[model samples]
Target: MSQNYPQLDQATRDELVRAYIAIQQIYEEKGSIPKDSETILKRYQGLLETLGAIHLGLLVASFSIVLNFFIVNYILHLLP
Candidate 1:
């Protein structure tokens, strides 16, 4: 089958990966977190948002990587 997504070019993919890495780094650096538990929770929420973004990117990439290849080969075989 053909790709379902709109225009998701290489630059968009690269930016998504970069943002995901940056969010991951921030989440790992607990030392930078504030002393209050509430503040830490707030920071964690931001981290979760980043994680969600990363997860979405991975999902889209997987569709392109796995399904796209199969569709390409099938279409190529169909062509004379």
Candidate 2:
């Protein structure tokens, strides 16, 4: 089955083309450089630390939501 795609305006299409070209240029420049082992390790470590913090924050938020849900439900049940 053929699926219909949403039509984009001329301005939007032009912007997307510009973004694609910019990204292609960036990829070319990035591929030209091979960083030292230490530098690459440091960059990866920084990325890992950032992702870890994000995951920790999400875990805390989820735990708080679950705890609050139980507490709220317990309180509501006690009112009867």
Candidate 3:
């Protein structure tokens, strides 16, 4: 059986690629250095925060788009 997944737009795909590259670079750097759990944890935390912010921003943007659509339609219906 085959499963189909929704496609991401170019901008979203680029953002995901950038995030993946950043994570890979961090791992590469860590491998070359003496193990420092604190630093690695901090780096992961920072990345998680940044990704969380991006997710929040996208959520707000989507909500605003939907709200605007409803608001505009409501206004249009109000016009004689």
Candidate 4:
């Protein structure tokens, strides 16, 4: 029974079963497992997220330098 499969979620049992059958069919047709399963997609997604974070950090640092330069120049201009 499907209830015996622990990995099956409460709602996705049918979908997972269909995908599993498709994977089997693909293996029969091409003799190899598909590498683009869910886990691989998550890993690539996380890598993209980390690269985005690095870019954001660089932008923030560049803006901070420009802001500090303007503040320092304005203060020096007001000195007697």
The per-residue C-alpha lDDT of model 2 at residue 70 equals 100
Q: Which residue pairs show collisions in model 4?
A: none
Separately for all candidates shown, the number of backbone clashes (residues 3 or more apart, or on different chains) is 0, 0, 0, 0
Candidates' RMSD to native: 22.3, 12.2, 17.3, 7.2
Better of 2 and 3 by lDDT: 3
Error of 2 at 44 (Å): 1.0
Candidate 4 per-residue C-alpha lDDT over 7-77 given as tens digits, one digit per residue, 9 for 90 to 100:
76767887777898998888867857654465665768978899999999999999999999999999999
How would you encode candidate 2's per-residue C-alpha lDDT over 1-80 as one tens digit per residue?
A: 01232477667777888998788778767985443335655779978899999999999999999999999999999996
* Highest-TM-score candidate: 4
Question: Which candidate tops lDDT?
Answer: 4
After superposing candidate 2 on the true structure, give the runs of residues whose Cα lies further than 4 Å from its correct spot.
Answer: 1-41
C-alpha TM-scores of all predictions: 0.43, 0.49, 0.47, 0.50
Backbone clash pairs for candidate 3 read: none
lDDT per model, in order?
0.79, 0.79, 0.80, 0.83
Residues 13-65, candidate 1, lDDT per residue (tens digit)?
A: 77888998787678667656443456655768988899999999999999989
In model 2, what are the clashing residue pairs, if there are any?
A: none
- State the lDDT at 13 in candidate 4: 82
